[model samples]
Target: MEINPAITFQHDRKVMHAKRPKVLIVGAGLGGLTLGAILQKSDIPYEIFERASQVKPLGSCVALNATVAPLMRQLGIYDEFVAMTKVIPSIQIGNENREVEFAMTAYFEEATERFGAESRVISRPALYDLFLKQVPKERLHMSKKVLTTKQGGNGILIRCSDGTEYEGDILVGADGAHSAIRQNLYAELKSQNKLIPSDDAALPFNTISLVGQTRPLTTEEFPFLKKEECQFVRIVGNDKPFAWSTFTTKQQRICYSVVQFLDEESSKLHDSFRNSEWGPEAAGAMCDEVRHFPVISGGDKITTIGDLIDLTPKEYISKVMLEEKVFQTWYGGRTVLMGDACHKLSPAGGAGAGNALQDAVVLANYINALPLHPVVEEIEAAFEAYKTDRIEWCEKAYATSKMLQSVVDKGIKPMLVRFMMKNMPEFMKRRAAEQMYSSRPQVAFLPLDETPASVKPTHQRSLNLRAPVEEEVEAPAKTI
Candidate 1:
């Protein structure tokens, strides 16, 4: 299909407005920002409402693979994104004694060659900034916490805490795990007896993590920072229920996180923390506890987790509960949810952020295909098709996250899982990496990426819907 830029003439504002549905996206997180970026590229009208007054650098780092690289290129930010990231050549797993139990080195080269994109790590703020630059400041509304939402005969309306109301054809809940939109949608569904019993249950998790990035350090302090590839090291505790990891970034800084595996007793101890707001204050107590843990930073000079914590600015440190659940209810009426709001994954596997960005691509594609004046039924169908296209991949990512979590978990089963990983064949590891990188979906309404890769990407149904009108009418088989 030959794609043309969406027209927006000063004199034809009415015609431009009638070409696509107006989108109201809640939560200016990774998913929402990405969707807004894609919508902007497609010239679809969108407004983003974020509850936070300002962007806070909470999390440590995100490992983005080939899965979302093409989309980044489509958004015109791939080169800048690559410039800020450090390619992770290999991951070395060690014991509490600082002994290397096993190192995963075989698949990095093969995966890069097969996928045409390297698995790279960038600090959370860098990633946030990369996407933030794509969105226009006027379209972004901070401190606009959505108080409530209602669907009327005309469209959907969201009333913010600031007492301002905005109406749009579609409402997207891109907020985090405890999304307000999901809560409201679920409440409405439950009242109608359409909510799934499993979806109503609380998100379940057994791990808590303290993540932060250290200020730039000299090579004299950490020699590994000079390497071309990232120095990714993960170490398990001796008898303690903790594991610590460090990744050297491109900006001469070390991004680190400590994971705590909780049992029934310890889980209750962290009840208050789990229920607290998502930010840095909650990470204070846990920071002191893990400071004494050792880190393998690749040199004779030993460093403790506390050292890195002390080096990190207080605002950048955060304690996060790694909740792992794939919620069944994704949308209802004109309201829909994406990213962590729908499927919260443990960060151990480094798939959460990547999946969120990919969710934006698939969801935005379907939204772009929506009629200018879509009815409730048409909106629901688009949402259903988006869910159908993404849910399976989300489940696969969730499974992969759980498997990686098991390796760092404190139990006999986790040990066995680690043992299997330690002894797994190189070809099998490469095969697994290929499976993970196979779903590289691009922006459908925009020009498709021609980046070459050895592994065939999974077919995107949304791509077929973006054909020229004449060709589309001739075939007529691309309906969602």
Candidate 2:
């Protein structure tokens, strides 16, 4: 009896399917680790490589949007996340007078009712730890930095800085904004004379952020600041640019970050600030500046108390600052990029992590749906779909973040903006809220058949103006 070709193919696929496809995930950050956990639950074979030798509780707090809550729940770690983080109620925006201007909550109840999930805030390290728990230690590789990647007819190969090589069916570059795999892939595409560099855009606000922890203050003591709330207090008519936020954590720790936009000279001076000696003086100066600002009088005694402590200068060193932009392209072949790796938006709107997490979900879903023995054409097609699906949402987020930065960066002009904001009609405020909170298309890992029509990948839509279908095919896959 002769075995039919299709039957043989089916039998071979069954045997091969028993051994899950090997997925190599670069970077152990939120996006990468989340993808690893989701793949593990799906019983897909995978390995995660991080440049850090060991996991450290690094980075600051992240605010989750309604979209991410479901993904976290799906990973079986949502409760663990909640246990490790705080559920902030609303974000309050005000000025030096301590008067509340605007406040927006996460819409938790509505989010749960509509999306079956609620948003929460988690320290980066805590979330990472939770994700690490779900992944096996053996499958997690550390101190492995991807230097380059090569794709051939058979499989994709990743070359590391340590002179080691790993071959896999697919390579997911979750390495962030400056992704090595993504760079290498683009280099190859350019070598083939097919690379198209997207237009570069400048950040609307050039801001610096100083983040640190402070002694807890009661709601009554610091009436201007709310416990478990993100309060944005802007001080108008201040000599120097100043804005501060009070972010409460699950541990009842109040984490605060002060942001200011410096002009050319001040920007350089800030960069050259000395940690050993200058930091103390700078912190003291910053405190003095805050105390003298007109807004300090708006709150009770405890609220003004933050203006007294001369927090060690070294504490100022913990601040994370960035000058960001929305890049033109997010993909370049068998090795595509996601998250901050594509567009590094300002953190004003608290949507950076949310957008990045959504990118990972969408990309992972597209790749998992391909045939086990995928052709280069099929891989390219999937990447094209991912890029097309995400551009607009990313752009909108990029724009919104910049606008928020502009409002905060206001030096002498804040008074004018405030006047307009205060005088704006209720109808106008509602319209703005609708735009701000409107749900964009989310990329999920559901089977194509189960994906809702509204949730369909952005690439499939004819409405994409920024990232058209024809433009997506311009760049061909290449080895770095």
Number of the top candidate by TM-score? 1
In order of listing, the candidates' clash counts read 0, 5
Please provide the root mean square deviation of candidate 2 (C-alpha atoms, Å).
9.5
Cα TM-score per model: 0.93, 0.74
Best by lDDT: 1
Question: Candidate 1, residues 1-480: lDDT per residue as tens digits?
Answer: 111113211332323335467899999999999999999987678999999999987788899999998998888788999899998888889886667778877557766568979999999888998899999999999999998888754578889999999988789999999999999999989998999999999888788999999899998788889798898888988798998889999888889999999998988888777667767878888988898898877788888898898889998888889889999899998899999999999898899999999999989888877765666777899899999999999999999989887777777998999889889987788888878888999988887788888888989987766522211223346668
Question: Candidate 1: lDDT of 86?
Answer: 91
Q: Estimate the Cα RMSD of every predicted model relative to the unseen true structure.
A: 6.8, 9.5
- Model 1, CA-based lDDT: 0.86
Flag regions of model 2 displaced more than 4 Å: 1-21, 96-119, 199-205, 214-237, 265-299, 302-317, 411-480
lDDT (Cα, tens digit) per residue for candidate 2, span 16-106:
4233346888888777877787677664578989877776543446778655665666665667777776655555666666676765442
